[model samples]
Target chain A: MSKKQTKEITESTIILPEDIKKEYTILNLGPTHPATHGIFQNILKMDGEKIVEAESTVGYIHRAFEKLAERKAYYQITPYTDRLNYCSAPLNNLGWHMAVEKLIGAEIPKRVQYMRVIIMELARIIDHIICNSVIGVDTGALTGFVYMFQQREFVYDIFEEICGARLTTNIGRIGGFERDFSPKVWKKIEQFLKEFPKVLAEFESLFVRNRIFMDRTIGCGAISAEKALSYGFTGPNLRATGIDYDVRVMNPYSSYEDFDFIIPVGTQGDTYDRFMVREEEMKQSLSIIRQALDKMPEGPFHADLPEFYLPEKQDVYSKMEALIYQFKIVMGENDVPVGEIYHAIEAANGELGFYIISDGGRTPYRLHFRRPCFIYYQAYTEMIKGAMLSDAILTMSSLNVIAGELDA
Target chain B: MLISQSVQEKLINEINEHFQDALVKHEVLYDMFTITLKREAVAPLIRHLYNHEEFKFKFLTNLCGLHYPNQKNQELGLMYQLHSFENNYRIRIKTFFPINDPVIATVTDIFNAANWMERQEYDFFGIEFKGHPNLKRILNVDDMTIFPMRKEYPAEDQARKDKNDIMFGR
Candidate 1:
């Protein structure tokens, strides 16, 4: 055993020197975190408790939906829309279908338009209930979340009864809804409308004047009107900054002009203002739904475009023309007009727009969604900067940053 | 009511004067003008739209990438939907790039919202924004190789690969 031979061969271990002087901490805020609403991640650089910088890392729950939409026929993409912003599935479905209809120049009937308005408003209520209540839950108010969830469940029950699906409600087809609401469904919806206001009042009472909630929200995540405009922030988030703009009033897709409603605006564009704006919006939505239900016209629920719309199953077996039309529509043989149309709907979050380009084919040449969550999320860093870590959670919840809509 | 025909004509004249030899086409439908700028002129034109006091399209409402497989000369198009709250008018600034190299200047400085939208466009179509501060895959993972929105990359082609390989890679 010479000196070289006698040396013990220790297990090779590479101990990399840590950057001890760099006083930065990284926090991974989950692809499955509670505040995210869906699978999303944020890589946060922190100095003690303050976020120095945060980079949002999305795509954990991306369905490659836009690409998937390109592959499927126009009708097939309705379900995919449901996956995006599933909390408000009907609105997404309607927005996508309306975009397709606009591209093809398919005339939607007045009754169908009224029905769309009703369903979309209902979807807005469901979305707001979840959004407002989730903010409450995150801010240490648990009872309000339960109450709002109960109300949301009631709305989901209505959806299930009407469309045969709850979360992924592929309710509407290209020209119109899949089916007409039966008298019983209408009655149930009327009942829901009647009961919902009281529940909303209760929900409001829980958080509206609560000192703790107000303390956590007021003056936190304050975005000014100029900043909101510069960032292209739309919906309640923009309205919270006192912008008297609503896509329903501005653009008036699906005959929203017929309805009489005021666009509620907030003075200070803070977390509390956003919440208050949404609360007022829910009231407006309830009124819209009630008005739509009372004034719903009695006519065919769908358009008369046999080539594009699906024929009844009974007619498919009995009538050869119906069968042929159905086959052609399903097989992507229908000739959609060659044009591009941008249809924007006032979704629960904001402006949910569908830009469809048709090359005289059944399938869309190109389809792009203007998801509201995407716009609101752009101000995430601006909103959360200089705020406490817990304020970030509250601010995010108040913003209602739905990952499905964001990633889509 | 917000955007007069004279404004459109004035914009066309300005663009023509600024970028000689660039082809600018306007389509009027749905009470909005979709102004198609040549690829090279898009950045400067957008810059003008932002800086110009008369037009002040301060808000970049939405930016999206469109792939037209059948179009001969202009297959890959980028549509910048701009909304001016001050003027209450909307304009679409569309530009096309060749299939091989889809490159455009990052408009994040003009409109901060373009940061994520450009990232999304890059994620889907492999469109490169030359000066984007943090241009990376947004909706797609960092390790993703193929741009999903390209005409050549069909969903089925990726579906054929193993799920684990597609997501995490082999």
Candidate 2:
């Protein structure tokens, strides 16, 4: 227990000089850190301020969405999908509805398609607004986040008008929308369209040319195009890496083929490129929304599939067929054909896909959500390997790793 | 650039020719081509598809596991959805194996993205990836022994007996 005994023990241990010199500090970034933006944890092995190695730990909020989907009816699963990218809940809802529509072979009307396009574009705009502005917030500029959040609230108001909910707006039905966009909703949309562009321009101007912002993000956490693709990156992240593989463009569903928009790309695949790509994409989404509004098709909003689409309350009370249809749907007794279908949508984050396998049952036999956040999150350790700890935080914010989607 | 029916047939034929009998069954449903292949053929077939001159599915869009307890020996299955941006084609490659021996070769060598996906599959369905560098529970607790996604495991708690599925017509 004395100094002489300690010296003897150290002499016998045979410690290498390199081992002492290369000693690394282990830093736990978060299970609940403010910078993580979500509930996931990152264990970083560091040498002073530089991250030597990084390991990401997720599933702090794993709700077993797939297993839950197996028990719920086809329509019942839409609400769960809403929780997956809560920033753009309507996209998930529509994606699930479209998957069911694909399985049921329900021909969605042109009006329904246009309505979906409008809502989806709106969702895309708000999602990008959040991601790009958060990148600003991470780079020490809080003004943009505060500025753009008001626009997000306006978008949420539109969603609330469409569905009676805000955050997890289970907006649409399997066959089509639960109801058509009310006049008030249309007015809100028009208002948003009229105002959002100017606000977006103002937000972009705040950070796009700021010297400090550029210095923090331009070369920080860059990934090669091949590396990004190999890591299964999609949506804005993949497009930021210069591969223009958008699910909406490649496999157009809900009449995306009818719309005209350009996919924005970036060269460096760094934080700056990602922010720029998203910024340009927001503009494109605004244009797409304008187009959808200009070319709005006039027809029945909901499809004629009574079994999947719930009947009106008055009709259910009066008509026998409507009552039966309502009963069947509410009781989850609607016959779903045994089939396997994978429906992918260009969700705000990436390619959010629903892989559903039905077995002629009331519920899906097996359901898997190809959550883009979960797919892209695996690349985090590789991306942040040797970067500074602060740069690692910026990379995460730019990546927009939503814990709900990641753990779903 | 939707891949035409003839082009889909050609891709199927090429897959058949390249892997020869490893291709179990292929079908075009809802304009999406899906092929069920032998378990051993998955990694090589994926590699071949990745490097193919035409219909090069260089990008893996999704990977997940499925459980079919009533499928006798083929109780566990893995689905790999690949995409070719150039061809604008998406192909779903599925393979099944016995649940008792839920082991398959890892595709991380071909696609780095497959690392977490394979681990997730392992976590949910207990499908062990043979060459996975880090095979562990991802979205679930590390100490948890059961694969929660398998058909044998009930989605809800077993203790909840008050509500009956039959009463709800499920």
* CA lDDT of every candidate: 0.83, 0.89
Fnat, one value per model:
0.61, 0.75
Question: What lDDT tens digits, residue by residue, belong to model 1 across residues B13-119?
Answer: 88888888675678775546888888888878788888888878777877999887778767888998887667777888888878777888888877778888898
Query: Each candidate's root-mean-square deviation in Å?
Result: 7.9, 4.9
Query: For model 2, how does the per-residue alpha-carbon lDDT over B1-170 read when each residue is reduced to its tens digit?
Result: 23578987897788788887898898876657888999999999899889989878898888889888889999899999888888788888899999889889999999999999999999998999999999999989999989988888887764687776786642
Residues A1-408, candidate 1: write the lDDT tens digits: 656656455654433455335587888988788666677677788877888888777767777777777777888888888877888999989988887777667899999999999889989988988888888888888898887788788888888888889999999788887788878778878888888888888988888899988888899889998888777889899999999878887777898898988789998989899999989988998898888877888898999888788899999999999999989988878777778777788888888888877777667777788888887687887777766788888888888888888877
- Residue pairs clashing in model 1 are none
Q: In model 2, which regions exceed 4 Å deviation?
A: A1-20, B1-3, B157-159, B162-170
- Score residue A245 of candidate 2 by CA lDDT: 81
Give residue B44's error in model 1 in angstroms: 2.5
How accurate locally is residue A366 in candidate 1, as Cα lDDT from 0 to 100? 79
* Tens-place lDDT digits, model 2, residues A1-408: 655644456665897776686778999999999988889799999999999988989999999988888888888888899899998889889998998898888998999999999999999888888899888888888888887999999988888888889999988888888777889998999999899889988987898898999899998989999999999899899888898888888888989898899999999999999999999998898888889999997899889898889999999999999999999999889989889888889999999988888888999988889999999989999999889999999999999989999998
Q: Distance from true position, residue A301, model 2, in Å?
A: 1.3
Superposed by TM-score, candidate 1 places the C-alpha of residue A400 at a distance from the truth, in angstroms, of 0.5
Q: How well is candidate 2 docked (DockQ)?
A: 0.65
TM values, all candidates:
0.90, 0.93
Please give the distance, in angstroms, between residue A322's alpha carbon in candidate 2 and its true position after superposition: 0.9
